[model samples]
Target: MTPFSQNMVSVSLWITVVMLFGSLCDGGKILVVPVEGSHWVNMDILIKALHGQGHSIDVIRTFNSWFVKENSTYYNSITILNTSGMDEEFVEDMLFKMIDYERGKGQMNAIQLYLHVFKAIHKTHEMICQLITNIFESEDILKTLKEKQYDLMLTDPAWGAGILLAHELKLPMVYNVRWTTTGEGHFDIAPSPMSYIPVTGSGNTDKMNFFQRVKNAFSYLLMDIQNSRFNLPLYQSFCDKYFHPRVHYYELLQGADIWLMRVDFVFEFPRPTMPNIIYIGGFQCKPAKALPQDLEDFMQSSGEHGVIIMSLGTFISDLPDDFTAEIAAAFAQLPQKVIWRYTGKRPSTLGNNTLLVDWMPQNDLLGHPKTKAFIAHGGTNGVQEALYHGIPVVGIPFFFDQYDNLLRLQERGGAKILSIATLNKNTLHAAIQEVINEPSYRLSMQRLSHLHRDKPIKPLDSALFWIEFVMRHKGAAHLRTESYKLPWYSYYSVDVAVTLFAVILIFILSIFLAVRYLCVKCCSRKRKTE
Candidate 1:
C-alpha cells in the first residue's frame, strides 16, 4: 500500500483512458474495399479525407490489377490481392454460358434476357460469393484486419463480401452503392422528376417510354428470380457456416448500420430516401492535381479552343474498328485538341491534333483549367468527375447502368447523350461542338459543381464522421429500418388486397345476374301455364 505504488497505478489508468478517448474522438481505424474501377476513385478520396482528419485507414483493393499494371501507386498500408485471376475466369465462364444459352434458344427469346440473367448471377452469386470466401480464407488478410480492429468497414454494395466481413467482425458496416443499385431504387433512394425506369403503360407520372417500362419491370422480375434461385442459396450456405441458423439475405442488408449512396440530391431532385440511407453525392472528387507534362503541352498547343478528353472506360474498350474510325475522323476535324484513352491498337491516319494513350489520370485531366469538355461512356465515376470539375460531357453509354446514368446527366442539363449503336463521325462531331459551344450546358455543369463543392463538409469527411459516429455508439442499430424485412409486394403496396377486392366484385356481379335470370325464367313459365 505504498504511495509510490498507488501513483504508478493511477498513471497507468490515466494513460488507458486517454488512449480510448483519443480513439473515440480522433476517428478509429476504417477498412475500405471498393471492388471495381470507379469504386477506387471514391475510396481514394475517402481515405485522403480520413487521413486529413488523423484517422487510420487500410484499403483492401480486390480488383486493382485490372486498372494499374504496376505496383507504383498502391500505398504501403493498402493490401492489393490478385483478384483478377478469379474475376476473369468468372466473367469468361458466365459470358460463354450466356452465349451458349442464346445459341440454344435460337429465336425463342431475346438475347437481352440471357444477358440480364448472366449479369445478375455473375455479379451477385459467383463474384460476390467467391469474394466473401476468399476474404474469409485469406489468413493474412483476416489476421491484419483482426490486429487493426477497425471500428467500421465501408464497402461498395457490389462487393457483397464487405457485408459478410463486417458482420463477422462484429463491426458496423455501411453499404456504399456507388451507382444506382436499381433504376427504381435510384428513384426510391433519390427521387427525381428526371429519374425514369423504362416501364410499360404511361401517364404524365411515367418517365419511361412504353417498351422501356416493360423492360424495367421485366428486369426487376428477372432479378428477383435470379436472387431467389442463385444468390439466396449461396448466401444461406455462408450464413449457416459462419453465423446464426437460417439467416436471410434481407436480414444482412437490414443489419447494416447505414447505407451511403454516391449520388447528389441536387441532380437527383425529389429523392425518396429512408432514414438509414444518406445521399453523400459527389464523394468521388479529390483536390485538383496537376496534369501530366505531355498532356499539359498538348493542351497549350490547342490555344484558345481547349481539349476534349475521350474515354469509354476500362470494360467496354473493345470498340469495333468502324466506331474507332468514326471517332478518329471526328477528332481529326475538330479545332480543339483530342486526348483519347484507347485501350486497343491505335488507329491509322491519326490527326496532328489528336493524342492516343492507353490511359490518363482522369480526375487530374478533368481538374485541368484547359479541359473544356469530356466525352465519356457515362460511367458513374466519369460523370461525377465531369460534374465536380464543372466540365460538360458528351455521354455515349454502351451497356448496363451507363444508359440510366447518362439519362440523369442529360436531365440535369449538364451533359448530352449520343447513342452508341448509331455513332458516326458527324454525330460525334456535332455532339462535341454542341457541348463546347452551348453556354447553357457549361453553366448548368458549373452550377451543379458549385452545389457539389459547397456541402457543409466534403463527402469524404461526412463518410468518415459517420464511421466514427458508429464506433462511438458501438453500432447505430437505431438507424436500421424494418421496411427491408417486408416482402417486395408489401414494400411496393401491390399485395393481395387489390387481388381480393377484384375477385369479390366479380363474384358478386356474377351471382346477381344468375339470380335475376332464374327469376325471369320462373315468371315466364308461370304465365305460359296459366
Candidate 2:
C-alpha cells in the first residue's frame, strides 16, 4: 500500500472512534411536565439531577402550575403553555374557599369530600386539556418539541392531561407520584392488596380488625365508583377529542415505563410493589444547611426551650384567621418559640413569642438542632421532611392525604393527630405538649431518619441510575411488571379462586353421589334376601 492510502485509512478509523465516543457520552433529552402545586418537588429534583448528569432537559410550563413559578429556571429551556383564566389567584381563591367550607361547615362527609375534590380536580383537568390541545394545534410549540426529540416524558398522573400529552407525543413516559399513592392508580401499577396496604384516605392500618377491613374494602369500591362516574369520563372526553376517539383513559395512564413513587417503607406499610415502581421518598430532603440570619437569631433566642416550625404548605397556606388565632393562643402558652407560615390576616392574639412569615425554609428549619417539633398540615412533603430531619410532629391535617400521613406518623409514635375541624386552643396546646414532651416521639423520628439516610445509594443517584438505565437500554420495558398487562381478575388471582372453588364443589358432589349409590345397592340386596 502507498503512504498516502495508509494515512487516509488511519484518519477514517480515528473519525469513526470519535463519533462513537461522542454518541456514547450523550444522555438523551428529558421533558418534564410537572403536576399542579407542590407536587413538582419530585420532578424538579429529578430534572436538576438529570441536568447535572449531562442530559438536556426541557420543561412545559402551564400558567397555573406552581412548579413553573418555582423551578422553571433549572431546565435548559421552557415552553410556556397558557391556560387562560386559570391564574394562581383564581386557584388560590378556589382552594381556600373549599378548605374553609370543609373546615367550618363540617357538613361534608368523607364521600362528599371525595366528590368535591373530584369535581374541583375535574375542572382543573378541563382547563389543562384546553391548554394541551392548544399546544398540539400550534405548529411552533409542537415543532420545537419534535426538534428536541425528548427521549422520555416525566409527569405526575394526578391529572389525566399528562397522560394525554404523553400519548400524543408518542414517547416513553414515567409517572411520578409526589405522595405515597395517587388514590386510584394502585390498580394500574400493582395489586394494592386491601389485606394490608391501606387505600388513600381509607385511614385503615395494615392490622385492621374485621369491621375495619370491611370498611376499607367499601372505601376502595367507593373510590373506584367515583373515578368511573366522574373523573374518568371527564378525562376521556378530552382524551377522545385530542388523542384518539376510543382511548381507554385508564389504560393510557397505565402505559408508564416507570413509576417514581415518593414513598419509603419507614413511613408506609409493608405491601407489594412492582419492579418499575421505584421509591424515591427522601429526594425532596437535603442535608442540613445554614438558616438565614434572622432564622438563626430567632432559634438562638429560643435558647433552651427550642423552636417549633409551623406551616400548612402551599395548598392550605391560606387558613382562616380564626383558626390561626387559636394556634397563636396555643403558641403563646408554650415556652418554645413558634414560627408560623401564614398568608392570611395576622391572628388577633398574635403574641410576642410567635413569628408569622409568608414563607420560611421548612426543611432547613426542621434540620436545625434548636427545632424541637413541627406543627404541619400533614402534606406528604411536610411529613416526609419532618421524618427525614428526625423532628417529631404535631400534625393538624386539614384534608386529603394529610389525614392519612398524620395517621401513619401517629401509628409510628412520632406524631400526634389533631382534628383541624375541631381545633381549639386547648387541643392544640395539649397535642403540642404531648409531642414535645414525649421522648418516644423524638426517638422514633431519629430511628426512621437513620434508616432513610442509610441507603446503598442516595435517592438522587437511585433516580438518576434508573433513568439513565432506561436511556441506555432504550426504555427499561423489561423492568416493568406484567401486572399492568394482566386483566383485573387475573392480576388479583380471582380466576384461580374460582377454579379452586369449582374443584371443591365437584369433589363434594362426587362423594355425595357415591354414598347414595352404595346405599341404594345395599337396600336392593336386603329386599331380595327378604
Candidate 3:
C-alpha cells in the first residue's frame, strides 16, 4: 500500500476511537424526586456529588419554598424542577384558618382537637395525590424523559408515587429508606419502629415489670389495630392492582432489587436486616461551606460564650403556644446566645440574648466555628448534619422516626434525648449544658463524624455506582428474592404448620370416636339377639 493511504487509515481509526469514548462518557442522566422538607438537603448532596463524578442529575423538588426561599440560586449544572403545586404561603394560610377555628370559644379538648386535625390532614391526601399526578403528568417532565430517557431513578420510598413513576418509565429504581423499614416483628415492610404505633422496645422483653409489660402489650395492640384500620385496605388494594394475585407482604419487600437505608451500622445495631438493603448513613454530609453574611454577623455578635442553634424542623414550625413557651423559658436562662429558627410570630417576652429568625441555612450554621451545640427535633437529616459537623445535640423529639433517631444518638454518646411531653425549663437547660460542657459528648460526635466521612468513595459515588450497575445488568433480577412468590401462610410458615397439626389431631380424634361408636352398637345388637 502507498504511504498516503496508510496515514489516512490510521487517522480515521483514531477519530472513531475518540467518538466512541465520548459516547461512553455521556452514559445517561438520573432524575431524583425527594420528599418534603430537609430531605431535599440530602438529595442535593447526592446530586452535587454525582455531578462531580460526571453524571448528569436533574432534581424535581416537590416541596420547595418550605425548605428554601423562591429566589435562591442553584449551581449551573444542576437543574432544579420546582413542582410543589401549593407553596408555603398557601399552606401557612390554610393552617392559620384551621388554627383560628380551633381557638374559637367552646373548642374541644386536646385529644378531640388532635383527632380533628388528623381528619383534616387525612382529607388533604386527595389534594396531595392530585398534586403528585399533576407533576408526574406534566409535559415538561415527559418531554425531558422522552428526550434523555433516564437510566435510573432514585427517590424516598415514603413517596409511593415514585414507585408508579418507576413502573411507568420502565426504569430501574431504588428505594431510599431513611429509617427502619421493618414492622414490629421485623417481618413486615412498615415505615419504622419510631414512626409506627405500638412502639417496640426492650421493655417488652421477659425482664420488664408487670405494668411495663402491660403497657407495651397494649401499645403493640393499639398499633396493630391502627395499622389494620388505616393501611390494610390500601395495601390490599395496591397488591391487587400491582402485585401478582396473591403475594405476601414480606415477599413484596424482598422482591425489591435493592433497599438503601440511611442508617449507620455504628448505630442502629441489633437490627434484623435483609441482604438486599445497604446502610449508607451520613449521606447528607458535604464539604463545609461558609455561612451567609447576615448569619455570620449574628454569630459574631454571640461573643465568646458561643451560640446554641435551635431548629424544630420545617413541619412543626407552627407548634402549640404551650410548647413554644416552654422552649422560650428554657432559652431565657441559657448563657450562650440562642439562635432560634422560629417561623411563627415572635413571642412578646423573649430574652434579648435569643435571636429569632424566619429561616437559616442549617448546614452552613452548623459548620460555623462558633456554633457550640445543636438543639434539634432528631430528624435523620438533622442528626446527620449535626454529626457531620461534630456538634453535640440536645434532641427534643416529637413524633415519627425522631424517637428512634434520638435513641440511636444517645446510644452512641453523641447526643441526649429530651421528650417533648416532659420538656421543662430546668430539663432543657441541663440538656443544653450537658451537650455543650461535656467534652466526652463532643469527642464522641467528632469520632463518629470522622468515621462517617472516612469512606474512600463518597456516598454519591457509591449510589451512582449501584445505579449504573443496575442499568448495565438491565435490572438486578438476581437480587430480587423468591419470598414474594410465597403465600401468606407459607411465608410465615407458622400458620400453615399449625393448621396442619390441628387438622391431623382432629382427624385422629374423629377416627377413634367412630370406631368406638361402631363397637358399642355391635355389642348392643349381639346382646339383644342373645
Candidate 4:
C-alpha cells in the first residue's frame, strides 16, 4: 500500500480500537430518583446517553404521574413508590386547582405567588415524607440499596428527600435542574448576582431599573422567608428522623458532587458559574423529526400562511374556559393554522383555522418549515425549544419562573410577554401579529439558535462527559467550591463588612476626640491670656 493510504488505515484502526475500549470502560451503575414527572423529561438525554454507553440504570418514581410514563425498557430497573391518597385523578385535580388559582384569581405579586407555591410544596413534602417514612420504617430497602453499590446517584433536587436518600446510601449525587434552584436549598454553587439575575418569580430581566431591582431583591427575601417558614422546617423534621442529629439538610444538599444545570446562554442571560455546574441547557430536547401523517397534512395545507403552535405545558393545561375562548378567538383571526394543546372543554370561539388536540408534538411542530410562531406560557423548556427552533413567541406567562423566562425573551427581541390579567382577544391577536410580522424577533431567535448549535461538542455529549468525569474521579470533589463549607455570613462577606465598619468607627471616634482636645486647649489658653 502507498504511504498515505497506510497512515489513514492505521489512524482509522486506532480510532475504532479506542471507541471499543471506551464503551467497555463507560459501564457503571446509576440510580435516578425524580420526584416530579416533568423532571423525567429533563433527564431523557442524559439517561439515554448513559444507557447507550452501557451503564446499568435504575429509576424510582411515584405511581400515577402523568409526567412520567411507564417504560420498562428505558431503565434496567423501575421502582414505583406508592403513597396513599395519591392517584392520577387526585394529582390532576390538584394541578387544575393550582392552575385556576394562578391564572384566574391569583395576585401578580411575588409574595402572593410564593405563599401559594409554599402551600403546594408543603403538601408535596408531607406526602413525600410519608413515603420515605414508609420505605425506611418498613422493609430492608436500605439494605438492598447498600448492596447495589451504585457508582453515582442522579437526582432532581425539587425536594430535599433525594439528597438525604443519596447521603444515607453513601453515594455521591449529582443535581439536575430545569431552572436555577440553587438558593432554594437545592445546591450551593456560585450565586447569581441579584442585581442582574432575577429571582425565580420576579419577572424581571438581568438589566433592571432601580425599582425593578428593589422588587427583585424583595422577591429573594420573600423566598427566603417562605423556605425558612415552610420548607426548612419540614426538611428538618424529615432529617431528624432518618439521618444523624447533625446531618443538616442544607449540608446534605451541599454534599452533591456535580450540578447539571439546564442553562444555555442563548436563552439565559450571562451569569457567573462554577466548575461543577455544567450547562447542558437544550440537551433534553430531541432532534426535530418529520411530523406524523395527519399533522403533516394540516401543516402542508397552511402552505403560505404557515402554522402557530400553542402549548401551556403539562401542569397548567386546563385553563379557564373564558380565557381559552378569548385565546381561541385570537387564533381564529390569524391566517396561520393553529395547533392548540387543550385538555379541557373546547371553546365555542374556536374556528376552522384552529385544531385543538390533547397533545401536539411540540418539538416537531417548532422544527417544521411552515411553523411561524409559538404561543407559550413562558416555561423554561418551551422557551428553550422555541429558541432552539428559532421561532418567535407571544408569551402569556401565568406563574413561577415562566414570567422571568419570558422577560429574558422579551429583552432579547425573541418574544412579547403578555400578562394573563390584561389578556383579551384583541391583545392576544395583536401580540401574535407583532411577533409574526416583525422580522426582528425571528432574526434574533435565528441568531440564538445558530450560536447555540455552534459549540464544538454538542450539549448532550458535554453533559455525558461530565457525568462520566464525576464517575472517573470518584465524585470529582476537587471541582467543588469550598464556599459550601463557609457559613452564610462568611460566604457573603458579612463578617468582612462588619470588620470594615468597626475600623471606620474607631477612626472616626479618634478624629473627633483629637479635634475636641485641640479646641479645648485653644480655649483654655485664650481664657488664661484674658
Candidate 5:
C-alpha cells in the first residue's frame, strides 16, 4: 500500500476505535429540576444533549407546567401532583399588568413596577418552597426519588427546590444557573463589584455615572431586601425545619459543585466569577436547517430585503390592541417580510408582508441567511441566539433580566432599546430601520459572534464535559469554593476589620492616657517648686 493510503487507513481505524469506546462507556443518571418558560427551553436542550450522550435524565415538573410536557423522547419526567406554585396564568398576568402600566391604562410607576416584580418573584419562590415542601413531606414521592440512585442532581437554582433535593438525597449538585433563588448567580458566588458589574434590572452599563452607580447600589439593596423578606422567611425556616441549623437556602445555592452559567463575557460585562462556572452561552444555537417548504418560499420571496423575526419569548403572546396595531403598522412599512410569533388576535394593521404564527423555529429563523434584524423581548436565550447568529436587535424588554440583557447589547452597539411606554409605529419603524440600515450594528454583532464562536470546544461540548466530569468524579468539590460555608461576617471580613479597628483604637487610647498622666505629674512637680 502507498504511504499516504496506509496513514489514512490508520487514522480511520483510530476514529472508529474511539467511537466504539465512547459508545461502550455507561452514562450516569441525572435528575433535572428545571424552571418553566424560557428557562425550561434551554434546560430541555441540555437534557436532550445529555440523553444523546447516553445519560439517563429524569426531569421533575409540576402537573400544571406550561412548557415542560409529561412525555418526551429525551428524558423520563416526574410529575409532582397538585403542587405547581407558578404557571402560565401567573406569568401572563404579570406581563399584561406591566403592559397596561406602560400604555398608561393602569396604575404603576417605577417604584410600583419594582415592587410588583419583587413581590411576584417572592411569591414564585414561596410556591417553589411549597413544591419542595410537598416533596419532602410526601413519603412515597420522596422515597421513590431516593430510590432513583441518580449519579448527580442537575438543576436550575433559580427556584431553590433542586438544591434541597440534592442535599436531601446526598447527591452532588450542579446548577444550570444565571439567576439563583435570591438574584443573579454571579452575585451569590462571585465578588461582583457594583461599580462595574451592573446589578440585574439596574439598566446601567459598566460605565456608570455617580447617579447610575447609586442606582446600581440601590438595586443590590433591593435584591438583598427582597431576599431577606421572602427567601429567608420561606426557605430558611424550611431548611431549619428539615435540615441542620446553619444550612441556609442561599448558602446551598452557593455550594453547588458546578455552575453552568448561561452567559459569556461577549454578552456580559467583565466581572468577578468563580472557577466552577462554565460559561455555555449560546449552546442551544446551531446553523439553520432547510426551512419547511412554505417558509422557504416566503424567504425566497423576500429576496434582497431579507426577513425580520419578532418574538416575545414564551411568557407573552398577547398585547394591547393599540400596541399590536402599532407594532403591526411598523412591520407593514418595512421593505422586508416580517414573521412574528403571536397567538393573539390578528392585528387589523398587519400587512400582507407580515405572517403571524403560533410559534416559529426561532433558532432556525435567526440562523437563516436571509434573516435581518431580530425584534426581541431581550430574554437571555433570544438575545444570546441573536448574537450567535450575528443579527442586530431592536429590543423591547419587559421584566426581570430582559432589560439588562438588552442593555448589554445596546452598550456593545449591537442593539437599539425602546421603552414600552414610548413605543409607537414611528418609533418602532425607525428603530427597525436603523438596525437594518446601519452597517455598524451588524458589524458589531458579527464581531461578538466571532468572539463567541472562537472557542476551542463548542459551548455544548464544554457543558457536557463538565457535567460528565461532575458525575464521573461524584462531585466537582475541588473546583467549588468553600467561601459559601463562611458566614457573612467572615466572607466580607467584617469581623476581621472590626477587630483590627478595635486594636488600633485601644493602642491610641493607651498612648493618650499615658501622655496625660505624664503631663499631670509634671504640672504637680512644677507647682511644688513654685
Candidate 6:
C-alpha cells in the first residue's frame, strides 16, 4: 500500500478505540448510600454494573456492617465507626414474635403486634439518627467528602440518612428502592388511592370488596400514623437542624430525580406511576450456570420426580424445632428430592430425601430444568427470581411484607400461601403437592415470566441507561413532577374547588336580584299611571 493509505488506516484505528472507550464510560463519580442485608444484595448488582461501565463509586456504610464488605474491587467504603441501624438481634426477636402471633401460641393481640412493630421501626430510626449525627458531627469526614465533589447520590432510601446526605451535598439523588423509611416507594412519589391500591401488609389484591377496601384503608392509615409518629420525627429533627426550617425531610425524599423501583407492574398491582420512576425488577436474575459437581449430581438424582428448593432468604434461617420437624416430615413424604437452606440443627424427622445446607445457589437451582417448585419466604429477590424462571411457589411467609409479596403471586394463580402460624406436616405437604401437581400454577408463572421478559431491553441495561442519563444530563429534573413543592390543599385542588363553588353562587344571586328589581320597577310604573 502507499504511505498515505497506511497513515490513514492507523489514524482511523486510533479514533475507533477512543470512541469505544468513551462509550464504555465517562468515569462519572457516584456516591452510594445503601441499606443492609437484602437491600445491599440488590444495590451491589447496580454498583457492579456501574463499575463495569467505568464509573467511580463510593459507598457509605457502618464500620461493622452485616453484609457490606469494607474491601471490594468495584467501590470504596466510607465507614462510620461503631454505629449502626437495623439491628439483627432486635429485628429477629420481633420476627419470631410475629410468627408466634400468627400461630396463636402468643398472648399478643393485633394491637400489641402493631405496637411491637412500631417500636422496632422507631428504634431503627433512632439508630439512623445516631448514624447520621456521627457523619454530620465529624468535621474531618464532612470536609473530605465535600472535597471529593460527587456528581450524584444513589441510595436505598429505606433509611433517610441517604436523603439527608444528598441534600447536604446538593447533588442530584436517585433511589434503588422498593420501600422508603416510612412506607412503600410508590406512595411517596405517586398517587395511591386506598380504594384500589392495597397497602403493604394488608394482604389484599388491587380488586377489593367493601370490607377488604375498609381493611386496606385502615392498614394505610396505620402506616401513616406509625411513620409520622415514629419514623419521620427522628429524621425531621435533623432536617430542622441542618437545613432550612421550611425544607421538610419528606420533600427531600419525594423530590429525588429518579426512582429505580425494584418492582414491576407484572408482579406489582397496576397503579399510577411517574415518569422518573423506572421499574427494574428481576435485574439480578439470569440464565442458570452449571451447578457445582456435587449439587449437579444431586439435582440429577431427583430424576423425573424433579426437585423442590426452600430458602428463607438472607436472615432467619433457623426456625423452632417443631416448625423444622413439621417441614422435615412433609419433605420425607415427597417423592421429589428437597434442598433446604437452613443454618439450624437437624430435625428428628429429616428424611433421606431431604438435604439441608447452610447455603445454596438459589437462582441457579430455580433456573434448573429439574426444579419443579420453590418453597420460599416471599422475599422480593426470591420471588422475582421465581417469576423470571417460571417456578411456582408454596409461600411460607414468616414476618413483615412477606405476605404482601406472596399475595401478588397467589392472586395471579402462580403460588399458594402457607402461614407459619398454621403450618404443619399435612398442610405443608398439601401445599407442596398442590403447586407441583397443579398444571395451572406452573402455567401461570410461565406466563408471568414471558411478560416480564418481553421487553425492548434487559431490565439491567435499562436501569444502566437511566442512571447514566442522570449522570450525562446532571439530573432527570424535567421528568420529575413539582407536586412535592405544593401544599396538601393546593395539590388536591380544594382551594380551586371552593373558588368555583363561590363564583357560581354569586352569579345565581346576581340574576335573582336583577329580576326582582325589574318586577318592582314595572309595578311602580303601573301604580303611577292608575
TM-score of each: 0.76, 0.86, 0.72, 0.87, 0.94, 0.92
Q: Could you arrange the candidates by lDDT from highest to lowest?
A: 6, 5, 2, 4, 1, 3
| Model 1 residue 306 lDDT score | 88
Query: Candidate 4 lDDT, tens digit per residue, 1-530?
Result: 99977977886665566456755355899888775545566776578778888888887665655555557665854444666323445545554455555466643354564455567656777776665666576557767777889998988877665776787788888878653223422224667678887777776777899999999999888777766777667767878877765577766777678888787788777777777777887886656899899999999999898999999886665666887889889888999999998888889999999999988889999999999999998877888899888999889876556787888888888999888767889999999999999899999999888888766556776677777877777797888878877888998899999999999999999999999999999999999999
Mind giving the per-residue lDDT tens digits that candidate 1 earns over 354-422? Answer: 989887988888888889899998787788888889999998865456766777778879999887545
Q: In terms of TM-score, which candidate is strongest?
A: 5
Using lDDT as the measure, the top candidate is 6
Better of 3 and 5 by lDDT: 5
Q: What residue pairs clash in candidate 4, if any at all?
A: none
- Candidate 5, which segments miss by more than 4 Å at Cα? 1-25, 244-246
Q: Clashes in model 2: which pairs?
A: none
**Whole-model lDDT, candidate 6?**
0.90
lDDT of each: 0.68, 0.77, 0.64, 0.76, 0.88, 0.90
Better of 3 and 4 by TM-score: 4
What shift in Å separates residue 39 of candidate 4 from its native position after superposition? 1.7
Give stretches of model 2 more than 4 Å off.
Answer: 1-25, 70-72, 76-114, 178-185, 238-247, 493-530
What local lDDT score does residue 159 receive in model 1, on the 0 to 100 scale? 49
Report the Cα lDDT for candidate 5. 0.88
Ranking by TM-score: 5, 6, 4, 2, 1, 3
Q: Over the stretch 1-530, how does candidate 3's per-residue lDDT look in tens digits?
A: 89977977886665566445532234557766555566656666665655654676665544443543333233222223544433455445444444444445225565665465445433333334444465555778566665668877776654444554565566777666652123332334422333222254322332346676667667666556644565333433454555544644324434456666676665454444665566677776676687878778888988888999999787656755755777788888888888999987677557888989888888888888899999998878888889888899998765555766777778789999886546767888888988898899999989988877865455654565565666666677777656657666776798878999999999999999999999999999999999
How far in Å is the alpha carbon of 379 misplaced in model 4?
A: 1.7
lDDT of 4 at 14: 52
